[model samples]
Target chain A: MSKLAHMFLLLFAMAGITYLIRMLPLVFFRKKIKSRYIRSLLFYIPYAVLSAMTFPFILYSTGNFSAAIVGTAVALIAAAFRLSLIIVAVLSCAAVFVAVLIL
Target chain B: MEQSPLKFKHGIKDGLPIGLGYLSVAFAFGVQASILGLPALFSTLISMTNLTSAGQLAGITIIAALGSVAEIMLVQLVINSRYFLMGVSLSQKADATFTTGKRFIAAAFITDEIFAVAISKRQAINFKYFIGLAVLPYIGWTIGTVLGAFSGDILPANLQAALGIALYAMFIAIIFPPAVKALNICFTVFSAALLSCACYYIPFIRNNLSEGFAIIICALVSAAVAAAIFPVKEKDNE
Candidate 1:
């Protein structure tokens, strides 16, 4: 295969695999889960998953420890107030920028 | 399931910040594609099709290295597997109005940010609101990819680096509010954080485990433990 065709082939494979992973459960698993244990577990998955992804990773995300720390602190405070997602994200990014400049 | 008063308009409004965040991250991806001698069109196409950051990066690396088609599929499956869990969770969150066709359409756009926002809704999301929520971020990601491919390094390094934290901050925002009100949720989040830290720090696990698997392990273990300890008496249909 030519280079461009090869790239397209690879892209399609990636897209196909990803779409399958996302699409299957929603399409087939429409019934409400019966078990309280399972339902509660699902409820907690989002928080648990997001939390794991954020910390330690967030510390290294900005490539500067102090900036990331500042950003995280601002995000925690802003989130505690139940601020909108936009505001909290913007505040975090802005805090990281200012921290980067000063430190 | 409680009927959500939210409509397409609310989705658009909620999606704006997510779109803004995607733009910066997609821009970085675009620049990486450009560095690999790929054109702006290709990078934009990848963003349009995949709509994911880490998966796209891994895909392109495999492509550049002349890896096989099987390698592409396997790597993407491993990296993007989190979407499987998210899909299962969101499937339960969707209202009756979220039919087969709507689920099919909405499933294509289930990124981490989009899933987080959708799951955070107090009521079950219907198809219209979910689609409305998805539009802007999709466009923003595509546009950002094109811009990055064409105008590489226009933004200052500090600003771009700062933007890197935007998605994580949004994640924090999503997980924190409910945490304060419920002690169980607080414990779950804290436990997941500790487990994740262990995955990051322990040399054996750090070296052996991929980022994607580490997330799955931490989330599943913490959530299962929490559920066993504090099972909800009734499922909150909200």
Candidate 2:
């Protein structure tokens, strides 16, 4: 298959699943979903998913591993204070940019 | 209630920060996706259709690794499934002004940030407010992708390389604030990381399990274990 077609097929599958996930609950649930286990599961998914995705890969995302580490450390510190997302992102980028330059 | 122009404007105002934030993050996504050899046009298309950073990025991995259809579907289901809860939570916020059809339309743009704003609104949301709330961020994401995609040609190599770190930084900014607030969450995230690190290094597991599957396993197990150990505060779940 052509690469574009392959990409489109993959993206289409993703879009369909996500849209269903987002739309189903709103359409079906008039009352709040009261299942505590499900609720807790939902509550923790974002943190867990983002954590799994970010780390390990973050160490390898930059041009240099050391640069990625420095950038990630700076970002965590910025986020610890609940700073704006943009500020944290820029700070992390700048940290990596400088780290790569120096090392 | 009538479709109020004032409410729509307020929604737009509320969406401004989200739009600005998406512009930067989606710009990072664009650069990252393009760096991975994805065409700029498809990157923009992903943003336009998905409006999610992690899901789209993970999907890119699946595509890059030539993951199968079942793998792609399952991974997206696991990663994007949290929106199901958000949708249920936001349904209560929809006012009588919304019709059945409008509800479906509104759900199309029910994103994390958009839902946060909509749910926090003092008044029940109408279709107009939801539209204004979702439109700007949607545009910002797509436009940022376009800029990042094309900017690859213009940006010097060093700067482009630095921009790659933006995705990691952005993810850190997202998870850190919440992780710090809750001890169990701290444990959950770390455990998930450790598990993936093992998967990345363990040749038997690493060779057999794709990145998408590894992510699905790590996410479900970590969240489930955390929930069992530290069930969310009852009040906060409401």
Candidate 3:
């Protein structure tokens, strides 16, 4: 197959898998999912997901330890102050880029 | 609270800010997809179907890395597992009087931002507002992807780099509100950053892990540690 055709097939399969994961709980667990403990656990999932998503980016800019340290410091300060999302992210990226340049 | 026919109105109102924010991020994804050599139509289609920021980024990265179908599926499953919890949380906020059709529609639109706003209302989520919230963001995401894919071809490389800032900005926005008063949140975020950096520097660990998996591990570990040390007291049922 051509490269385009290959990409199409891969994306199609990926979409199918993604949709199934997202839809399964709503469909299969509709009637079976009635518990308070599970509900409480669900509340924490977003926080967990968000933290996981942000962690790596703040560390290891361009796969370097020093840049990661600088980036982490900047992100922590911005996050602590509750700065705007755009500001913190931009600051972190800039900090990392500058740190890599200097160190 | 008084019942209003403008239920969907509220959703639209709440969704507008989020939708605006989504436009830039989704546009970046579109550009990335195009740069990766995916067709413009395919890029837009992915955005329309998925409507997720991190998931789309992961999907594009995995595809670019030439991961096998099995690997892609596993990644998607793991990355999106959190949605199951979100869906269940949404169910509690939903009205028992709502029909299956309504639930399905609402479930389809249960994004992180939408869920946060809906849950904060502490009322039976109005289907109208839910639909309203979904509408603009959906359109913005689809259109942004298409536009970005097309524009990626013509945009200067420097401009593209600047546009990339939008995604990070959105993350900062989400973290800012929660961290304002909470030192523990700050510490947890910092710790996760440190851990992620260590994982990156360690050749064996870095080679074994994908970004999605790393994110899940870091977030859960940091948050779990923070929750243990700084527990929130719950109100007793009267």
Candidate 4:
């Protein structure tokens, strides 16, 4: 299959799932979720998912292992300081660029 | 209950910062899309249709890995499920003006930032305000993607490689603030990371589990375990 066609199919599936998840609940369900387990699970899911996606994979992101490590460290520190997403991302990328140069 | 032009203007005013923030992250996504050899138009369309950062990034992985349709659908379901909660939460904030038709229209705009801004409003939201709030960010996100996709082609190889970490950095920025606030969240993040690391390293598991599936498993297990252990109080639920 063509790359464009494949991408479109994936996009359609993603868009459809996402739209339904948001729209169905908003349009039909007015009640707050009652279960504590579900609520806690929901609260924690984003953090967990992000963590899983970020680590290990991030180490491979920059191609250079040392550069990626530098980037990850910078990212962690900047984010811990409560920096905005843009600032943290830029700092991390900048750190990697420097690491690539020096090493 | 009537939708007022003034309120719509206020919504646009509120959305500006969010639009600005989306620019950098969306640019990273665009770069990643280009790296994956996706056309700029499709990358922009992903932003236009999805309006999400993590989900789109995950979609890129699935596409790059040649994951099946069911895989993408399932991954999107797991990753974007937070929107379900946001949508349900925002439903209470909608005034009588939010008719069924309006609800459908508004649903497309219910992003994390948009929902946060909408829910924080003192007054109940109307369709006009919601639309106004979503427009600028949508435009910003698409524009950023376009810029990134085009620029990725011209950037030096070293620089493009460095920029590859941009989305992951954003992910760290997102999870860190919350992780620091609560001990349970800290544990959840680390455990998920460890699990994901294992998946990446272990030969047998690594060979069998696709990237999408590994993420799904790690996230669900870590979250479920944390939820069972922590069981955040009802009022603490966000």
Candidate 5:
């Protein structure tokens, strides 16, 4: 198969999987949801997903511990203070990039 | 009395920033896709169809890395798993007022930013507002990809890196507000970071795992661990 064909097949598979995962809960669980535990579990999922997505890239940018440390420190401070997301992200990225450049 | 057209105007209002933000990031993705030797149109179409941030980003990486179909599917599932929760939460906001078609349409356009803005609105999420919200971002994402793909030559390399930062910044913006009120979120963020680092250093996992799979593992593992340790009390959501 051609690379384009291969890429499309993969994309279709991904679209199907993603839609199923996202849609199932809403469609299947549409009626009165009785499980308190399930509801509670659902509440934390977003936070967990966000963390998993963002944390590692911040640390491993330069393949060093220090860069991650400084980047995390800057992000934590900025985020904790409720700085704008763009500002905090730019600062953190700049911090990592600069740290990598300097060290 | 018919609701004023202005009632729906907010969707466009809120979507504007999101649309502008999406342009740069989507463009970056297009450039990356081009760099990987994929046609620019492919990247733009993916953005149009998927309308997801991390999933698309991971998809390109996985495709470039030449991962298997199973791995790609699994990675997409894992990376986008949170949307399941978001969809459920959104259903509550949508209430029974939404029909199946409406739900599907909303589901397709539902990015984290869009979800956040939609849920925050005091009014019922009418179709008009939802379409308004989806349209601009869709245009921004598609056009951005096309532009990036075509202009790959003229753009400076550093600018692309800077544009990539918009995505992370968007995440921070989304995560910060709620995180301030909740300690679990902070822990979850840190835990995710730690897990990601471990995945990076661990030779076998680093070498064997595709980016999408790595993301799935990190998200599920960290969320699972956090759930176990800090199990949200049943009363909290109530």
Candidate 6:
């Protein structure tokens, strides 16, 4: 198949998966769940997924690896202090921009 | 579910920050997709259909690399599998007013940021509020992608390069607050990092398994460890 056809097929499948993952539970289960294991897993998911997506990867998401490291440190520190998300993001970008300029 | 003007307005109010955040990240996504040789309009369509960052990026990368259809499906499913858990967790908190059709439609917008805000509300969530919550972010993400795709050439290289890191920083902001709140969360993230790092550094895993699968494995290992060793016992629908 051509790339456009490939893209169309892939997107259709993506929509299916995204919809299933999100829709099934919200639609089928109406009442409160009593499973402790499920609850604990859900509670930990945000941190687990976020960390998996953030760390190590953040070290390379920028233009330069060293700049990414510098930006991430600034971001962690800024976020720890309870700065807003936009503020933290901007500051992190600035840290990288400055690092790129200096180095 | 109730059609309260006040609730819809509050949802929009709560969603602005998320929309702004999505704008920057999705803008970067558009630029990144274009740099990879995908058309801008197609990239925007991806954003509109996917509404996810990591999953969509992974998909685009695979497409650019000429991966097979099976690869695309597997990669997206693995990366986006977390949404299943989130949906399950939200099921209990969802308002009774949501009909089947509304639930299906609303679930499409159950993104991380939207979920974070929705679940934290002290009151029952309504369909109108939830729809309102997703509107601005949906608009922002789509518009940002379009702008970046068509006008990305207008931007200087340095700023474009810098914008790439915004998504990672946003993820950091999301995770940091929760990590600081609970020690168990810190442990969970730590374990996840260790697993992800191991997958990246280990010669066999790096080549043998795709990045999408590695993420799933790392997350599952950490979450399973957390659930077993430090199970949190909050009542669902609380």
Which candidate tops DockQ?
4
- Write model 3 residue lDDT over B1-238, tens digit each, in one string: 4454437677777788878767766787787677667778888878877878767776776777666676667656656666776665566666654467666556656577776777677567756767887888888788889888899778765454444434544555566566555675666656766776776778998999876566657656665676666554332100
Better of 4 and 6 by DockQ: 4
How do these models rank on DockQ, best leading?
4, 2, 6, 1, 5, 3
lDDT of 2 by residue, B179-222 (tens): 78879889888888888788888899988988889988998899
RMSD values for the candidates in order, in angstroms, are 5.4, 2.1, 4.5, 2.0, 3.7, 3.0
Model 3 agreement with the true structure over A8-76: per-residue lDDT tens digits: 666777677666655555544554344543443333444555555555553422355776677667766
Least accurate stretch of 10 residues (summed lDDT) in model 6 chain A? Answer: A29-38
Q: Which pairs of residues collide in candidate 3?
A: A52-B215, A52-B219, A85-B169, A85-B172, A85-B173, A86-B169, B8-B128, B8-B129
What does DockQ give for each predicted structure? 0.53, 0.77, 0.32, 0.85, 0.44, 0.62
Ranking of all predicted structures according to lDDT, beginning with the best and ending with the worst: 4, 2, 1, 6, 5, 3
Candidate 5 clashes: the total is 0
Proportion of native contacts present in model 5: 0.46
Q: Per model, how many backbone clashes are there?
A: 0, 0, 8, 0, 0, 2
In model 5, what are the clashing residue pairs, if there are any?
Answer: none
- Could you give candidate 6's per-residue lDDT for residues A1-103 as a string of tens digits? 8878887777777667777878888888656547788777766765776677676778877669888888999999999998987788889989998998988
Interface RMSD of 4: 1.0
Each candidate's B-chain TM-score, in sequence, is 0.66, 0.94, 0.82, 0.95, 0.83, 0.83
lDDT of 6 by residue, B1-238 (tens): 3343337888998999889888878887887787677888888988998899877877777777766677777666656766776787677777776888888888889888899898888777878888889999999999989987776666777776677677778778877887788788888988998898988889999999876667767887898898899878574223
Supply candidate 3's per-residue lDDT for B210: 73
Q: 1 or 6: which has the higher lDDT?
A: 1
* Model 1 alpha-carbon drift over 4 Å, by segment: A1-14, B1-43, B51-103, B109-137, B144-152, B233-238
* Models ranked on TM-score: 4, 2, 6, 5, 3, 1
Candidate 4 C-alpha lDDT tens digits along B184-208: 9999999999999999999999999
Query: Candidate 3 at B118: error in angstroms?
Result: 2.0
* Error in Å for residue B35 of model 1: 10
Q: Per-residue lDDT of A29-103 in model 1, one digit per residue for the tens?
A: 655567788767766776787788787888987889999999999999999999987789889989999999999
TM-score between model 1 and native: 0.70
